[model samples]
Target: MKQNKLIGLGVATMAAFLLLSVNTAEAARTDMVDVSNHNGYMNVSDWTGMRDKYGVKSMVTKISEGTFYKDYTAANNIATAKQAGIYQNGYHFARYKTAAQAESEANYAATLAKQDGLPNNAVLVTDVEAAEQQYTPLTTNDYNNFIFMSTVQKYGYRTDIYTSGSWMNNIMTVKPGTGWIASYPYVVGDKQWYTGNHAWQFSSTQNFAGTTAVGNFDVSQLNDDFYTGGQNTKPVNPVTPPVTNNNQVANQDYAQTGTFTANTTVNVRSGVANNAPIVATYAPGQSLNYNHIYIVNGVVKGRYTSYSGQTRYASMGYIPGGSFGKRSAVSNSRTYTVRYGDSFWSIANRLGINMNSLAAKNGKTINSIIYPNQQLMY
Candidate 1:
């Protein structure tokens, strides 16, 4: 009887130990470090150090902006990151004045990636932000997104849209696809927006000095499963289906435009041009009129609607500050403090200014030396 009792006790002890191990693993999985652009410009050696020290599993880096593409640094960054054994992806900051312009930019980016050989775990992302002026046409923005996504799909690359939840739900329609939501919630009511998302930017001021990747704002965090074969898995194809109702046309509503029903199951593609393939599908009755529509390669693609209820179009022929305030003369008065790993080119890209302009603003050449915490006016 004592022998049997001893056996039973051993089994119970083993079960308890297993449970404890599982709980410990779950706790460990909760901790993640996000090395986004907030780290400024890190060279290959710098990134490799972070990967080795912090156990960084993944990274997202800026690749291009509007028509201006990053120099060899982008490819160098990706290659260095891969060598350091980290998953790497690229993002483009949208700066389209029209749908056509956006489409052109997307195509250019795809070509660059193809020419340079996309990284193994690459995810082509669209970073959408508001234009300088509020009155810019909504159609232009929508079409620009469409073409950008389309181009990405055409290149046989995964795609994702990175934006805030409010922008996704209110300003833009969330088609059937994943999103990198920038909703930082340190506590209750700190949420930036409320919506379903694949990854969440938990905080912008993470302290990583002691841990690893030091001297950078802990600017973002994501779900543990993000880029770990979960919903945040890099999209195999970023394109949505093509708009099926090519023949359906509606008048521009000056007020609130009621949602337009998709006459047939539609494929909402990602790119602005006819390059990328379909990434997701929208069924009949799926609303498109919630936003505005713009012309892309002569076809109308629906876009986000504005507060005035009218669909906006791209300023195709207009010059900057001409009828519409599509362009802004950059103010050379403001100054920015340089951070560790920062380069003039990287700083210029982040500031949305040309390298020469940035140099000129600071009374230095593009190759002028800059140091961490040094202020440069632009």
Candidate 2:
């Protein structure tokens, strides 16, 4: 079955080995991988292949970040995985500094989860580590954590807290729902800091041989219940797409002004090959425009032109004709903190900005050295 290939905000690898919820051996345990849009584009078939080859059954995908930001691939990833018969959960990368903000973020995550096809019986995780480090009002995180858990519970979904011992001990006082503890030396069962934890993410630098994914994989081991597909062994998220009344125009030539409905795992490729460099990602039900369509050997395909005026392409099966068209125009004209390994070229390329113009806007050269946590206004 195709599982959700969504990953979470960076969780440091686990180092310490403790006991498991059940008495399970540590030597021969299957690991689960978490991925996000940053891990690159992957279709349902790609995720299924990963599961079949690596025995990865459970996943934690990034659905929403804060109250404003939403993962571009959350909808499709959740839908495809649930449809493919895999254990999947959704998480929000929280940026709240107060209890009210945390509650709002929780509601935001739940709303997006519902829109993205996240199952009701699955876990909804709040990534609190980032907010603990970035947000202020030191005495407010405990209340924030409490409100977050309560809000998610109100939505008829279980809440899971993903954080380290330091954050738990230093920042927050109240414990939320279930725990997804992240510490070193990969431990199982009741952790030293938190008593109730379902899984332990051991390492973030490990790579999978069965897959061709770049960068290190965030590796984790699930408790017996989680390894067994959390709550529902046969979790279902079947697609019941609304019936379209538009007449099918067979062999209709692609037009410059034509729009297409993105049906999840939709990639905007720089070229026609499956391995082509991806230009952008679109959520399911998002309406996208294309420059041309290609019919190759009974297969339907379409070309999408990027903001850099580069023509990208994708298979047309997920690119059905639609009247709800909206072209992507990235105008992230706000201050953004520079993250690790971010470069002018990479940022410009990702945001569809002209490289030289982006540098000029920052009052820096195209080759200026960017450092971590440095804010850039574009």
Q: Which one wins on TM-score? A: 2
- Give me the overall lDDT of model 1: 0.48
lDDT of 2: 0.57
The estimated TM-scores of all candidates read 0.45, 0.49
Error of 1 at 144 (Å): 2.7
lDDT of 2 at 19: 20
- Cα shift from native, residue 205, model 1 (Å): 2.8
Error of 1 at 162 (Å): 1.1
Candidate 2's TM-score reads 0.49
Q: What tens digits encode model 1's per-residue C-alpha lDDT throughout 136-252?
A: 555555566777787788777677776654566444544643677554433412233323454555444433221224463323334434443343432121112233334433322
The per-residue C-alpha lDDT of model 2 at residue 214 equals 51
Give the per-residue lDDT digits (tens) of candidate 2, residues 1-378. Answer: 012211323333434331211132333233455666765554565456445434457777788877788888777777766665557787788778777788899999998888888777677887776734445554677667778878988877777777655555555543443566655444332333333556666555544432334555565556546433444322122221222223323343444335566655455556554445566766777755555665332224567555454666654441111111233333436555677878888877765668898889889998888899988876
In model 2, which runs have C-alpha deviations exceeding 4 angstroms?
1-30, 131-139, 173-177, 185-196, 212-215, 224-378
